[model samples]
Target: MIRPDIRTDWTMEEARAIHALPFADLMHRAQTLHRAHFDPNTIETASLLSIKTGGCPEDCGYCSQSAFHDTGVKATKLMETEEVLAAAQRAKASGAQRFCMGAAWRSPKDRDMDKLCDMVRGVSDLGLETCMTLGMLSPEQVARLKAAGLDFYNHNIDTSPD
Candidate 1:
């Protein structure tokens, strides 16, 4: 059995120990842990709403919306608050436990951030959890979103800043 006290953020030696374990052993341990904490038959589902489409400025080569790439995706303006609310309602009706809103940009503008805050507030009122992936948000922006009842934020670290 895997150690119940195992920390998710592993130390170097702990990571090495895990990596040295056989694949079957790892899977068995993971299965045992999962069954202990959650029902084996339970599978949670959620939906994503692309609240804002395209027009990103980053040079992330893997990103289709990067300004430097010719990925054939069209740029669109930020979505209105009502549009995002409607999508969130649809997600909730479809039995989603969470609804995630996403915008394509390197960073959100002040106006866009305000709109996002409003959207988050609206979604929260519907009793559904709301999350966002509006690219890189500053500390102040994150605090503002949290104040507006933002449940989660997705900020991807593209790579080691090497």
Candidate 2:
């Protein structure tokens, strides 16, 4: 059986040994752990909406939304609060337990924070979990989001420090 204790330090050899375990044994262990912590038959549904698309300043090569890439995606201004709320309502009606909003900005502008907060509150009021991926956010912004009832925030980190 896999160890139950949480661990932060693991040697490369130890990790390699675990990776070398028999496929069937690995699957059994994984399934057992999953069933222990969660309902095996239950599924959580989520919907993702791009509230603001394209025109990102960052030159992340892998991202199609970056202005530096010619990915054929046109830049659009931020959506109106009413429109966002309407989308959230639709998401809830379609049986999504979680609604996620994404923007193409490297980071949201201070002025736009108010609008974002409004969107979060609106979505949360619909009894659906709210999440956002608005790139990097300052501490104050995070605090404001928490106050607005945001459930999760997603920020992707580069694989290498290039």
Candidate 3:
């Protein structure tokens, strides 16, 4: 049964109070909530593949793929549609319910949007939910992605960061 106290929004003070709780206490609270709302015995898996690896111009300290960092990751062009589909196949075979494509970019260039959309379509055709995290996107770009039937568009609060 759904909890009667469930809410769609929380006040700042309520959020802060949760954040201020002791680590163990907070974890316990979260676990209790999860147990109440989710089936504890069920687990789902996802696979994240870097569709475009490295060469990001932004220098976010937390990222290893940034051009500013010497993480020894060489920049590469975007993976081909076939390559991405193969990875999605592997993921599905390994029991992943969703396939997430990630790119190390400040934002995908207009020239790259077509290829990105093709990748999303190919992955979705494989019977897996398609997701992408290609930095920032313009309104037009988002429309193209939506037209291609993208299931999710994951973005970070900080550009080019996790």
The best candidate by lDDT is 2
In angstroms, what RMSD does candidate 2 have relative to the true structure?
4.0
Which ranges of candidate 3 are over 4 A from the true structure? 1-9, 159-162
Candidate 2 per-residue C-alpha lDDT over 13-73 given as tens digits, one digit per residue, 9 for 90 to 100: 9999989999999999999998998999988899999999999999988888999999999
Cα lDDT of candidate 1 equals 0.87
| TM values, all candidates | 0.82, 0.84, 0.86
In the range 20-138, model 3's lDDT, one tens digit per residue, is 99999988988898999899788768999998899999889989889998999989999999999999999999999999999999999999988999999999999999999999899
Per-residue lDDT tens digits for candidate 1, residues 14-112, read 888989999999999999999998999997777898877777888888988777888898888888999889988888899987889888898888767
Using lDDT as the measure, name the better of candidate 2 and candidate 3: 2
- lDDT over C-alpha atoms for residue 70 of model 1: 87
Off by over 4 Å in 2: 1-6, 10-31
Which ranking of candidates, highest TM-score first?
3, 2, 1
Task: Estimate the lDDT of model 2.
Answer: 0.94
* Count of clashes in candidate 3: 0
lDDT rank order: 2, 3, 1
Choose the strongest candidate by TM-score: 3
Quality of model 3 by C-alpha lDDT: 0.92
Residue 79's lDDT within candidate 1 is 84
lDDT of each: 0.87, 0.94, 0.92
